[model samples]
Target: MKYVVTTVWKHPVKIDWQSMRQTMSKSKDNPHVAEIHWYEIDETTHGSVAIYHSRDAYEANLAFMQEHRSNSISERGIEMFPRSAW
Candidate 1:
């Protein structure tokens, strides 16, 4: 199973992308995480999408969110469907 975790936040001061990257780098030992990806929108929209592989997707998502306190996080499961038969 793959879970997507999205984080949104407003910084009191200008966000230092370098510091943020360093923070994320420290979580290399997190068991509930598989891959962490990030993106930014226009300006205020700053968020990260994390993909996790676990038997319990919901719990895994919650655990990841708990680790990061500065931002608001939301998690959703990804579902795929077959488009055609060969």
Candidate 2:
């Protein structure tokens, strides 16, 4: 399954891509995250579309979000199609 995780942080200055990358690196252990693509919507908003192999992966991601409150997930959507040109 594919999920589009959209988040808007109040403090754009605190947007730490490196930290997020590090956190995502732990996906090797989580194993649900197949791939992730992040986007900067604006100065204070960003989003990520992730591909999960199974429901376990999707739930794990949600659990992680609940535990980590630094980023505010304002909107979340499931992706019907998974493809990219870049």
Candidate 3:
């Protein structure tokens, strides 16, 4: 199933691009995850969103967040929802 995972984090002074890339690469290997995509938050927004395909979207999201936090980044999981028909 397709899931939308919303994450919010304080904009760091420097975004660790290399670390972020590595974290994402690792997330791709998660058994529950089939695929993932990211989008930057809009200027008026406070966080970013990642769309992922997974058998268990919630678990996939938790794993992603945990990995990021373990890397010394702080992030909050805002929501997880199945794809809307609309």
Give the Cα error of residue 70 in candidate 2, in Å.
6.0
Provide the lDDT at 27 for model 3: 63
Q: Residues 42-75, candidate 2: write the lDDT tens digits.
A: 5544565666776566776777756544233333
Candidate 3 wrongly placed segments (more than 4 Å): 41-48, 52-86
What residue runs in model 2 are displaced by over 4 Å at the alpha carbon?
1-29, 70-86
Q: Which candidate achieves the best TM-score against the true structure?
A: 1
What is the TM-score of candidate 1? Answer: 0.60
lDDT of 3 by residue, 1-86 (tens): 66665555444444455655775787667665555554445432244445556536656467666665555433433333233220
* Sliding window of 10 residues with minimal summed lDDT for model 3: 77-86
Worst 10 residues of 1 by lDDT: 77-86
Give me candidate 2's TM-score against the actual structure: 0.49
What does candidate 1's lDDT look like per residue over 1-86, in tens digits? 66655555544445567866887786556677777765654354456666666646537556554544513232222112221111
RMSD of every candidate to native, in Å, equals 9.1, 7.6, 5.9
Model 2 weakest lDDT span, ten residues long: 77-86
lDDT of 1: 0.52
